[model samples]
Target: MTLPDTPEQTPLTADTVLRYHLCWKHRDLDGVMALYHPDIQYHDFFQNRVLGFDELRDYVRASLPHAAGEDIVHSDRIRVDGCTAFIQYQVTVQGGDGLVAFQSSEAITVKDGLIWRINEYATLVRRNAKGSDRSSPRPATSRLGLSPRQLSTMAQDLEHYFQRQRPYLDPELDLQQVAEASGYSRNQISYLLNQVLGQSFYRYVNQARLQHLLASLDDSCTRMPVDDLAFAAGFNSLSAFYKCFREHTGLSPKAYVKQISLRART
Candidate 1:
């Protein structure tokens, strides 16, 4: 007796399947979403089947935020027909509290240039020896893993960069420039800001400028007007300066100055 082939055997074209995989790997939710029909249905290893556009949209929004690094090893494709395709791939994710190493399998189904469904099966693989096993543990590098000399160098570079570049005025100040100037990679900069500094890039730059502004305010010899002082402090706009100033100092710039003036008189 001869056994029949499995229903999971689906034929897919190379071009269509490669495009789907590219979109997924790039984390382009919009591109991936566009590949799905309005009435698409999808199922994952979680035993949940998402149906319709709204449900899929919400699911993607909620899940994408948790997605981190991707290390995919192999991806292959087959076309069942002109309208249907399947792709199989192995992916590794950083696990541990600091995102270490976890491996998984992903299967994507595309129909008529849209993703009809996706099935992913992920399993915990290994933990980093230096990283925490907690869900949201900071990276080991942030815990002073570097030598004392290296730490001192990094701190000195960070301070000097802030003083020299004055990145606050440039809204486009990004990790690449900072890393290059500090002799670090973009990943190193990101790790420094996220893990060591415990702040986002925008917040870190703004806080540094805000501190400088506060110091300047304490010196009466500087005769620049309040608005001019704000701009000179690297704030691009008066409104943004006032907003961040209030947030950092718990008082408007004018109010803070008045309080300082009154205190000095007393």
Candidate 2:
């Protein structure tokens, strides 16, 4: 089906962008896909995925379901330049007494009045009603009788296990194994990581893996290829490793290595 281009051939505006955003929030797959050009290129840099129209459609369909009952909080600022637009928003999902917000920004390119290309990045945040201060001490989970000190100790022990044992380097390492080894229930571990440490299990693990990778980089004698280094650091996918590395260090691996080399010379 062919969508009509704007009569005046005007670039996409905030209104046009909102139509697409609203369609996504409402989980209207057809409406979402209708705004895309037939030859669309969708780039999810975090996933290291570049998808065409068919893959884009499948991804949108699969992802929208997760937003079915969630609230979409859109930033008021939508910046448009020529045929491109930038938008930011957060998808808030219920998490026990609080909410877990996945915030994302998209750079969209429009052609012939349809979305021709898109690049998106996302991060997470946690929020609660009454706007409680996140830095304040958290109350113990009702399910676990452990005091704050006990939870803190468990978090530290878990960190030590992950760092010294390098279980994160195992692509198959999972919460169950960690729990079994540490004598903590999976729920308790998850609660400690999420509620106390303010991160998900995978997020904490990946951060550890990224740190491990950096330590390897620090060893000038290390001769492993960057990809091998990433794998050895326990990242299952190269894309995921790159994403995590960039998120943690604010630079890609190659750039980071170059910076380190220059610093050593200086």
lDDT top scorer? 2
Candidates in order, TM-scores: namely 0.42, 0.48
Best candidate (score: TM-score): 2
Task: Give per-residue CA lDDT, model 1, range 165-205, as digits (tens).
Answer: 77655655677777777777766566555654445776677
Count: clashes, candidate 1 = 12
Candidate 2: lDDT over CA atoms? 0.70
Worst 10 contiguous positions by lDDT, candidate 2: 133-142
Name the lDDT value of residue 5 in candidate 1: 26
Candidate 2 per-residue C-alpha lDDT over 98-166 given as tens digits, one digit per residue, 9 for 90 to 100: 454546689987777788889876554556567642433433432553332234346556766776787
Task: Quote the lDDT for 205 in model 2.
Answer: 76
CA lDDT for candidate 1? 0.56
Model 2, position 108, has a per-residue lDDT of: 85
